[model samples]
Target: MRDIKIIWDFRGPAALKTAEHHAIHLKEYAANCAIEYTTIDIQTFNEFYTIAFIVVKEKDMLSVRDALKPHRAEVYIKKRRD
Candidate 1:
């Protein structure tokens, strides 16, 4: 099955920190709710932009998306270890 990335974007001077903190919450939520996910992480685009994201199976996308209300989503392609 494919994966889906659910992203929450943050912007401002504190974007990176906020995104990092948000990723922690995403992990907690998944643990508490028994949600299956491949990864949860943060990405910093710049000082003013960052994002927190969780990658889950495509089958789990709708429920997670409804509960999390993320800013965006896309197909997640996992990088193969070579």
Candidate 2:
């Protein structure tokens, strides 16, 4: 299955919380729309930034994108077919 990973990077004060909050939105959207996805929040210490990840199938990309349109940044997509 081909999947796309949507990423949002947040920095500045309370970066971690901001990223987590964004993840919450993604999770809620998926739940409401009955979509399956994997989300992760990571804190980077080098310069202090948080990363939010949303992994969903290629077919579900648009729905996820629209749902996360408010705060969009650093979108990295991954795909694999085997």
Candidate 3:
């Protein structure tokens, strides 16, 4: 029952803002489509690169991936608060 991270990458000066906005749409899509997700977030690498990602259970990956057509994906590892 592992989780999967689906990621969409953005580049250029507007990358950060674009990634953030994409995360918003990811949330809306999950809500409207009744898609289960652990979280949706944007990661800033720098002014030139950013990514929007949605984490969902492995079982839900295919459906979400097909619908979203993200740039890439990987196994999701939850970070400990500590």
Worst 10 residues of 2 by lDDT: 70-79
Cα lDDT listed for each candidate? 0.95, 0.69, 0.94
| Candidate 3 residue-wise lDDT, 1-82, digit = tens | 9999999999999999999899999999999999899999999888899999999999999999899899999999988998
Clashing pairs in 1: none
Clashes of 1: 0
Separately for all candidates shown, the number of backbone clashes (residues 3 or more apart, or on different chains) is 0, 0, 0
- Model 1, residue 36: distance off in Å is 1.0
Selected candidate, larger TM-score, 1 vs 2: 1
Off by over 4 Å in 3: none
lDDT of 1 by residue, 1-82 (tens): 9999999999999999999999999999999989999999998888999999999999999999999899999999988999
Question: Clash number for model 2?
Answer: 0
> Which model scores highest in lDDT?
1
If ranked by TM-score, best first, what sequence of candidates would result? 3, 1, 2
Query: How large an RMSD does model 3 have?
Result: 0.8
Q: Which ten residues in a row have the lowest lDDT in candidate 3?
A: 38-47
* Per-prediction TM-score: 0.94, 0.70, 0.95
What is candidate 3's local distance difference test score? 0.94
